[model samples]
Target: MGKSTRNVKNSFITLSPSFFTHLLSVSPFSTPNKNPSPNLSLLFFLSLSILCTFSGICLLTFYPISRNSIPCSALSPSSPLSPFLLASLSSVLKDYSPNTRNYDEPDLSSSAMVPLPARGVAANPNISAEGRDFWKQPDDEGYRPCLDFSLGYRKASSRISKEKRKFLVVVVSGGLNQQRNQIIDAVVIARILEAALVVPVLQVNRIWGDESEFSDIFDLEHFKKTLQADVRIVSSLPSTHLVSKQSIENQIPYHVSPMWIRARFLHQLNEEGVLILKGLDSRLSKNLPLDLQKLRCKVAFHALRFASPIQDIGNRIAQRMWIEGPYIAVHLRLEKDVWVRTGCLTGLGDDYDRIIANERDSNPDFLTDKLNIAKSARRLAGLCPLTALEVARVLKGLGAPSNSRIYIAGGEPFGGKQAMQALMDEFPNIETKETLAREGELTPYMKRCSVLAAIDYIVSLSSDVFVPSHGGNMGRAMQGHRAYVGHRKYVKPNKRMMLPLLEDESVSEEEFRSGIKKLHKYSKGQPVLRNNKLDRDVLAYPVPECMCKR
Candidate 1:
């Protein structure tokens, strides 16, 4: 065994130089030297071929090195090799060591290969309890919210001729954040069509059966006032235009350009004088022009203010949380509907799996994931919602104290209070809207899901730290809102990296904790510009666009 190990080490040493040479030969610097000597060139090529042959033999003899067997010094930064070469070498080695691979190591060839942490683990684990103060304000990253719509507004207003200023009506449906997104898109669409927008009609929620109107949930007057300069807003369609109204039958395609919108609807709008769009959820493109994106930010952060009653109750809950000291808001998306829709097993064993399976069978349309991925594979892929136990473990691993105040925000979890037992045990100082508010305080909005979600939204926005067990509209909205207002610390759980570590029976507690910390070091709610090329939602990562450096 010792002799074999020695041979492997020697082989690796011998192969190293050939690998480095190969890299150099292919690099940009490998441009042919001028005035080359024929004899010297022949000799160089001959020697390079021999070295490559030797390297191939070495690789064949001992390619897969065991993590435990390899000496750390071989891969250390102190080596003579440049950092880029070292990184490349490490990546090559990593591709073979699947069993003991470090997921934290980024791929040198492609930055896109780096795993983004799922939405829950904190950025740093070393900060004290008072670290809450660190999140109250934006990071010192020289950027602030600056929605400059002056140019776009001028251009849009100029295009809106008296004959072309048609009326646009949108019927927005879904939960609070979904509707909020539609509302934002509705404004942008109105600008695209250069039409006066009628107050958005809120489709009665099928699940909650709540008949709350847009005016009931959001301050309509404020919405109109905030966009008065950008788009024309009206309470209702004009009597003459109502008869000429045309409802769009086909659902709009996702991520359409402004030109596509104009091409599709301009003629209809001109002919009919009014056009109605329904289920306008995520139909508009996320990668709109700067003005449109800024308008989205403006609508989301500024225009879409909650109604006074909802705001008052939400503020009361948030204040109550603050009184108990800084609290963390966790958007735990472990509801039954979530499980049914995601087709992800609850990790609560066979009985719970059967429950989810039965629900999925009863309503096949509920399952959003079309691909039939195994439950275990889905969990490993970070598709499953983190259970209460998993959330508790993540929080503890991130150094949140047992006494840390946590506010659970979401619909009732799948298993209800029983499902939350683990988290409650881990952190006793946990509260929900049901717990924080006085009896009958939330009674009015108890059945109103959107209003209740608005309450959760407010509390979440006020939190010193925000964590989402699953990614959704609310989480995405909160992420963008927090980044826009101030870079409040948001802990996106490194689920893809973390779940495997957590599941590995061989991993010790210390190893798991360290792994979790390392996975999320850069996953905090730091200021990052939205990459439009990647087609990431601007609302979730607004920087340098809606924001400007002072």
Candidate 2:
């Protein structure tokens, strides 16, 4: 026997004698009997001995032990316990004992902890076949995009003299949407400083390795024309200021007031005549003056038009999607980088988890949540991205038919097609850019990530129903854009509310569907004003400030 098994047996053996003695001492039969007979005493002892033996046998049979510690082959065929009995006992022990593990059994601990459905399977097997009216457009709620900052807004050109005209050159970094945000903020910052804004430079994407310039993605002439009255946007800095340029190395703090901007940059800009700012992403304040915020809306919605080629292809894709009836655009942000950076579990099993964990370990700074929350707790708190299974369940619950055509935006998911298998299984009629476009359509922009993202953005903007699986730059941009155009059907998953219900195995299909419907009643592109008190992004929730009610 192994050391652990021997120790267990020895401990039980040592305790057995004392246990019997204590039992006998506490028994009423043990009380002194004056007329006790020898035969009766012998029979009583025999009965007690038989009972003790049976109890010991039962204890041994049910005793929890490491399955590897004791070999089943050790028991001889002639032993009192039959093979069937031994197998039954093993099975019982396996069910009850936490430590007893069968190597042959699949590891369910991860799934149990996560509470997500199996790969390529819906969360609820019995999905409702009844179709939902996803075609109905959401109520506009009397709101319309009104970028009317004209009343109190002064043009920067009229305010700043030509002699004191300082040039502001900004280098915007990050992904497509992030860069878009930075570009909007750059214009606002230039207006704040009363400086001529040079066309913001697009930082080379480190991951994508695409050296795409600003002109490559956005229409240069249209951008300049749209903001001609607000600020002077030039292709390059003036020759006089080129040699005297000052670069700001430190990052500007978030939510900085206009006064702070003037105080910090006005004198330096005047002296140098040219200021170069890098890493301008989220550097500008969220709660700028109404005019600046309006300016922001104008820049984001109107000024920043996609390049001709990208626009043409994007419009073509959007037209194609529209031709096939109303289609749902799903911004499935399941990229490996997203998983690593957000520290969100992919629910693709332990292998993917290990891959993410490995990447996270290597680049600790990439993790968005620095709180060091537990994975399960993070998932429960809705920090994790909705898995393919979860997305399928949410759609089904929201009344999307099995035959609903889905246009999946965003890049290739972590596990490629396999990651999207569940969603495809739930709704087979799905199309992505590659599948939708012709052979030579996307050839030129094949390696251009930003351009590709722009294509997706346009298609998403025109989609009948837009569903973002997680909150990110793209989702936020789309939310505001859809609202600005008209309240299109946008479904923001109630992850915090829906995750617990999804994890709950006890919730029936009907109950799950009802719960989902209830959770998302007010979430479907409802025209609610942005809560500025909460410091919500105006770009994401552009309602009262950027919109006017009819």
- Name the top lDDT candidate: 2
Each candidate's number of clashing pairs is 8, 0
Candidate 1 residue lDDT tens string, 1-550? 1333222245335444445565555443466667544565565566677668776777755544322111222222342544234323243233333443234322212211111111222345654643443343335375555544453354455355232358988888888999999889988988888888889999998767889999889988777765665677888877787674355644788778899999999898888788888877778887888778877876787778888888888888887887655678999998888998888878677898799899889988877764588878877778878999999998877767777789999998887778898999999999999998998998888789999999999889878789999888998998888776556778888788887777888988888777877887776788877873548888898876677665
Q: Flag regions of model 1 displaced more than 4 Å.
A: 1-138, 150-152, 158-165, 532-534
Estimated TM-score for each candidate: 0.74, 0.74
Q: Which lDDT values do the candidates have, in the order given? A: 0.73, 0.74
RMSD of each: 21.5, 30.6
Alpha carbon lDDT at 63, candidate 1: 44
Tens digits of lDDT, candidate 2, 1-550: 2333222244334334444555565444787567655576566677588668767766765654322221222211234443234322232123333444345322221111010010111333344434434445667775655544443353234464232468888888889999999899888888888888888988888777888999999988878766665777899876777674355645778677889888988899888778888877667777777777877877887778898898889978877877766578999989988898888788888998899999999988888865578888888787878888999999988888787788999988999888999999999999999888998999999999999999999888877788999888999999988876666778999899997789899999999999999998888887877764647788888888877664
Model 1's alpha-carbon lDDT is 0.73
**Candidate 2 runs further than 4 Å off:** 1-132, 155-157, 160-164, 532-534
Q: What local lDDT score does residue 412 receive in model 2, on the 0 to 100 scale?
A: 85
